[model samples]
Target: MTVSITDVARAAGVSTSTVSRALRGRPGVSDEVRAQIATVAAQLGYTASRSASSLASGRTFTIGVIAPYIGRWFFGTVLDAAEKVFSAAGYDVLLYNLGTPETRKRFFTRLPVRKRVDAVLSLLIPDEEEAAALRSLEVPLASTVGGAREGFTVVGIDDHAGAASAVRHLVNLGHRRIGMISGASEPLHWTTPLARRRAYLDVLADAGIEHDPKLEADGGYTVEGGEQAMTELLAASRPPTAVFAQSDEMAMGALRALRRHRLRVPDDVSVVGFDDHELAEVIGLTTVAQPVTGQGAEAARLLLEQLDAPDAEPPGHVQMPIRLILRETTAPPSPRGPQ
Candidate 1:
């Protein structure tokens, strides 16, 4: 037989009311007590009765998390952070993986999450129509690592500034022929790829360097795409002296391509990446660092704020800062190069 809520409450030495409060993630329960309850309940194989709770409170006591892709490291980090936050708050999480427009349309048009979750947390999906459709839902909406259409709570980094910082660092190192591997094709609407590319172009123009179409490559925000774009950029008869890959994964791939071409990083060519992923430090890659985990937690907290008080202040945008990590991958152009 399935474990009963009363059994869980008895195991945790709490009353049925306390168990309900802890399980519903209702306010007034201490974090420690809630954790204890959750542990005991799990040990007893106790699952919350969503139907019963819905009948009583009209809430599923669940939060819906949507992301464009779960395969990316950054997106995965955000999802994990959000899950932890919601779990701590006594709420179950429902994940929706809508990577393409068709899937997103079907999800919203179908309203599959109806009566399933209390609020929806979208991670950097910025399609205007999708945002509109989601807003049509009666539930609360929150976003992390990107913005929404209008009247939504969003937490994300300042992509334009972050990109400018990365490119500026390269320019400060006297790199004039810096090429970019941009992420223009990522499904996420508010991703920083195109902004970074724009920053690169703007900085290059500001530095009085002629923008060369031959040097830039569309990397599509993946390691393999970066590797392929890097290969193409390196194959030019007059290759760029430096490159600013938009992602650390891409930078790693660029490093591989450079090694394949018998070129020494920072000696023959300077490179920069974004995100400061773990591998970036291991491989001594220069990149822009954004607080991804913090963004996730903050977005969850904001959603909780709305949940706690429905008639509270309206949601607004929150932009996180970025820092440049100068590692061994970036340096002045080689003396033998085009001077």
Candidate 2:
């Protein structure tokens, strides 16, 4: 005979409602009590029917994760960490990645995620229309991208500050002609590329370096794109002695381009990149590192807290810190560097 929740409650010496909440990993049950209830339920062969539990609790126990691109290292890493946090809390994740603006627009138009999730987590800042659609979901909302939205509890790093540090490091090393492999144009709400580029220019101005259009190339935030950008820089009448790629992937590409040209790093062209990607250490690329996992986990936790007490907690922003990790890829340019 299949054991029921009531039988587990009786065996655990707790009320049926308490047993239900504890078994479902809901609030109002202490960890000790929850553990004991879980043990009792397992021993009694009690398994929950998700549909039935959702109907009774009026919650789907699902988190909708929205993002434009999952292939990027940053997005993939964040999603992995956030999924772990949600899984521990007994919640399922629904990914909403369509890979293009057209598809995303069409997906949001119908709002298929409506009433199907207990909370929402966005990996990208939604536009006004997208934001409106998300708000229509009427669920706890949080984000790990951009600054605080009107309704989202955000957890992310300061893009300007992080990028500025990378450029400033090159400037401190006496690199004047610093080229930048920049990300391509993005949507209005996707302001990371703009913020990082602005920092690069602003820092150069501070150090008396004149802006050169020839020094900037669109990398599209991919390895091949970055390699192409670096190749463009090499073709410049006067290539920069140091280069800053907006992402580590691009920096890796830049390194490839330099190697193909038989040029030595730092000795010929010092390179810096943002997002100290996992491969940065192994490849000896100097980069600005942000707490990618921390941001994702904290954003998920904030959403969970809001789910626990909807409309009780004020939405807030968490500006996580970033640091520059100096590695072998950067050094003062050789005296024979481009003039």
Candidate 3:
């Protein structure tokens, strides 16, 4: 015979409601109580019926993830991590890729994610209109790789601190003529990579280095865009001695450009990248390693917390740590470098 909540509660010496909350992994029950309830429920062959529970609680136990570009390595890595955690907790995930401006507008204004999931998770997504749409949903919301505003929970690296560390590393390595490849254009809310650029500029100014507009190029967060930007910077009369690409893929593209122009890395032009993607280690590229996978898991946890208590606490910012990985990609400039 299947064990019902009544049987589990009787065995665990708790109320039926407590047994239900403990089995569902919801708050209000202590970890010890939850463990005891689970042990008894397992011994009695108790299993939850999600459909019936949804009918009783009016919650789908699902989360909606909104990503601007799901194919990118950074976003993909984080999404995989989130999926693992949510699935393990018996929650479903719905992904929405807003690739075009029109689609983004529709998603925010018309077809906002509603009634489908109990909460929402956004990956490095930035837009005031979109934020407003999420606010209107009345569902718990969280973001990864960016800060939370207006009560939306967030889990991400401190971009300003991380960018400062990256630049300081290059400066300590005796590099003064440094350039940067910034992310795509966004004038509203500050995106992670965009904040990185600002941090770079602020650090350069503090170090008494000139911020050359010519050397700072826009990569548009694509390999081809990085290639084009590197090409333009290299063709300049006075090129930078070191370059910082916003993402690993962009740095890889810049590497290709350097090779085509007979510019040897660390000898002619040193390079650094962000995200510390898998290719970074393969190519021996120095970069800052953000906890992409861990960030995803933590974001899911935060969203679940909000779902349990919509009025528990206003969402706050969370900063995961970052580390600077030194590799063969960056070195001091040669006496006679590419000129």
Candidate 4:
């Protein structure tokens, strides 16, 4: 027979109401009685019902966390950080990895998150129709994808400025023939990749360097993709003297490709990347550092704020700063490179 909250209360010689308050960590139960109830519950192997708790408090005590992908470093790190925050606040997290079209369709159509989670946090920006559907749920929503979304509480870094700084660093090192390792294109409403890509183009244009269509290769935001893209760049008629990879993972792959081709970094090609990933310093990669963990944590906190007080005003936005970290990977190009 499964032990229940009633068994715990009976064993502790307390009312069911007292047991509920004590086990749930709610107020009104004294420290001494709470300890006895806890001890009894453990000994009896009793567990409280989430449904009962929800009925009493009118809250699911759960937060829905949605992301485009989970295996990637950025997504995993953010989700882990957010989960920590939610766990500490007595809330469970329901993860949704809508990486494929089919999964996304199922999510929106089936509404798995409907009436299940008290609030939602999106790690990737949704399209207008999807956003409208989310809003229809009438729950507090937050995101850490793009900067300052209108209807959602947002926490993100300025992608355009961060990418610009990375490209400008290469330019300052006297590199005109700069190749770009870009990420795959995103959905129409997701502007993070576009913002970063636009920054690269804008910075080059500002420096009076004519755009070379062949200089940019899509990295697909993966190591293998980055290596392949780098190989393509190396085969260009006039290879770049320096390269800027949109992500550290891509930059790492670029480094590998250059090594395979027997080209010395900084001497043959200076390189820069975004996202100061954990292994970046280990490999001495120069990158633009954004607070990935902090961004997720803040997004969770913002959702918590709304959950705590339904009528409370939303926290408009939290735009975290980024830092350009200079490392051994970046330097002035060799004299043999294109002018």
Locate the minimum summed-lDDT window of 10 residues in model 2.
183-192
Ranked by TM-score, top first: 2, 3, 4, 1
Q: What TM-score does each of the candidates earn?
A: 0.86, 0.96, 0.87, 0.87
Q: What is the lDDT of residue 235 in candidate 2?
A: 98
Q: Compared with the true structure, what per-residue lDDT tens digits does model 3 show for residues 186-218?
A: 323547776898889998898888888988888
| Model 4 per-residue lDDT at 94 | 94
Q: What lDDT does candidate 1 reach at residue 84? A: 93
Q: List the residue pairs that clash in candidate 4.
A: none
Global lDDT of model 3: 0.83
State the TM-score for model 4: 0.87
- Most TM-score-accurate candidate: 2
Question: What value does the lDDT take at residue 92 in candidate 1?
Answer: 86
lDDT of 2 by residue, 122-212 (tens): 9888888788888888787888888778878889999999999999999999888899999856544788898899999999999988999
Global Cα lDDT for candidate 4: 0.89
**Segments in model 3 whose C-alpha atoms lie over 4 Å from true places:** 1-19, 27-46, 124-126, 186-190
Clashing pairs in 3: none
Q: Which stretches of candidate 2 lie over 4 Å from their true place?
A: none
Mark the regions of model 4 whose C-alpha exceeds 4 Å error after superposition: 1-49, 186-188
Model 2, clash count? 0
Question: After best superposition, candidate 1 residue 248: deviation in angstroms?
Answer: 0.7
Q: Give the Cα lDDT of each candidate.
A: 0.84, 0.89, 0.83, 0.89
Off by over 4 Å in 1: 1-52, 188-191
